[model samples]
Target: MAENKTLKVPGATLYYQVRGSGPVLLMIPGGPTDAAIFAGVVPHLTDRYTVVAYDPRGNSRSVLDGPAEDVHADVHGDDAHRLLAELGDEPAYVFGSSGGAVIGLNLAARYPGQVRTLVAHEPPCGRILPDAEEYLAGTEEVYQAYRTGGVEAGMKRFEEFVGLSGEEQEQPQTPPSPEMMEGWGRIGGNLDFFLGHVLRPVSGHLPDVAALRQGPARIVVGVGDASTDRQYAYRSAVALAEALGRPPAVFPGDHGGFVARAEEFAVTLDKVLNAT
Candidate 1:
């Protein structure tokens, strides 16, 4: 059974779900993609671990107390720390995808002892790449499109920017729920928060290499096997891993691999988690 709960942080009321048993494993979703995004992969991990997923502040059920402002990577990282502390789980295992991966990197660097192991999948750390200015400009362009036209137009540009145009985009294996549909309906607001607050901060975030290198937690950078080399996310993962003096661990499918290939992704995650 899954238990839905909320925690009051400094400026937001975070909504989180807990399920299964054993060691605690916290899963963090990408930009504005609330806890529901991990529904497919959570079930597989639940059998062996207590899976905890949450909606970040200003996204979905996790509402911010004040006006939505531009947020930094450390702010989100602090939220993750508060959530873990509220869950009464010290040094928990963490799996973070896309934007969430950047948060995990921040957490590992800033609050090292709070995380046992952090698996960061395809973090779009554009600043770490060679053509960083180009990538950053593209991200800004997507945000501008969102501001001018709307989510559809923005997403279209985003897809093309990430090399997901045409046949590259994968079909959903499972249908979305009513709750998810409602969330999608309100995605415009989330998109605004993402574009205004998250995009630049996360993409430009330079993880504290020295801090992370000296931190206690084990850090593992992940990249999707099917993710094209053209995508900055794939390249960023490789760059991040190299910075950490570790190789990027390859997983199944592309950016949304956890949902697109849940079974295989889970198995690979289990191995990575359990490996010495």
Candidate 2:
């Protein structure tokens, strides 16, 4: 059973859930989605880790204290640091996806003392790419697409940005479970906040690689096996891995692997976290 809780942060009230019992493993979900996104993976990890999943301030149940505004990766990073401090006395393991991964890197760079290991899965850190200017422009386009259109139109543009329809190494996809479908619908509903305010600032972050390399937290950059090199996220993740001087640990599916292939992703995640 997961215990629901909330915490008062600098500018928002964050909603979080805690389950299992052992070492702390904080799960930070990407933008547009909240802690509910981890429902499938949580069941598998409870035996070894106390899983803490949350809605990053403004998404889902985490209500913003003021009107909607642009939130930088470091702001979200600070939120993670506060969450960690409130949850446990010791440094905790962290797993962040997409925008959340960007936040993880910021957290590790600025507050490594609060994190033991940070598994950053497919962070859209375009600044590290060789053709970063081009990539950043495309990222801006993605934000603008959402600004002009909506999630439906924006997602189509995002899919194109990630080459989901263009040149992807299309792996056959199993129909997402009903739970996942429901989760997707909810995410779709809240995506305005993500595409509207969260996307640009988070994606635009230029990671402090020197700080991360020198920091105590072990940084594990992750990419999805189902994603190809041509994709924006795949390319950026690879670039980030190179910047970090470590090969990306491959996950099971594409960007949504943790949700689509939860059991396998969980097993792989456990292995990666335990490996020397």
Candidate 3:
């Protein structure tokens, strides 16, 4: 009922899993994490669609060369494109969370033809906000800490930024082993590159906030039910919905909504995605 495959992309080998049959839905994960984060959620949807989740070119099972110099959104976008191509030429519906959502937006903008529907959930594309300068500065601090002090420092800063609990923060705070660090470094490099090159420029070019207003392609903003009102993810979802002239549908749980309440989230997701 499940198959694992290795996909070779430009900078690394992507480890991915596929389940079920039907239209393909690409799930892009967040954090310094990978596909496994979606384990709980994938089962609920596999019966309705082909679910493809992969470790991005430098995370988890994926391998990469010495932290390729800065990596931009286009670089990450290219990986998504290559993975989708390998799966098949058919367009895919995409659901991306946090950093993944940011990547999804770039993919949609750059390769509009490849995306059938995009559920950009809680993207913290902070540059799109009115106070972008401060956000970028804070992000820079976190990246720098990660580079110098390691994962704990980086995660601490991230948790502070997102207002996560100390224990919840600890979940992803462990440093990557030396071997995994190489991949983390590559991913980190891309994160740095994205900050400078992609963030602001891409925000400036966003389609008329009115495009989603027409609804040929469903572009929905989803926020976690348990997320705090002030959390960046929730705020971003709110802002995106406002920009698109729509409202964000509440997902089943907190920021890791799909995983925390997989069954309910899948039901809601299916309803929303299939509505189009």
Count of backbone collisions within predicted model 2: 0
The TM-score measured for candidate 1 stands at 0.93
Clashes of each: 0, 0, 0
Error of 2 at 64 (Å): 0.6
Positional deviation of residue 93's Cα in model 3 after best superposition, in angstroms: 1.3
How does model 2 fare in lDDT? Answer: 0.86
**Cα lDDT of model 1 by residue, 181-219, tens digit:** 665665666877887777777877888888988999999
Runs of candidate 1 with Cα error greater than 4 angstroms are 172-189
Q: Which candidate do you rate higher for lDDT, 1 or 3?
A: 1
* lDDT (C-alpha, whole model) for all candidates: 0.86, 0.86, 0.70
RMSD of 2: 2.2
Q: TM-score of every model? A: 0.93, 0.93, 0.81
Alpha carbon deviation, residue 66, candidate 1 (Å): 2.0
Looking at model 3, the pairs that clash are: none
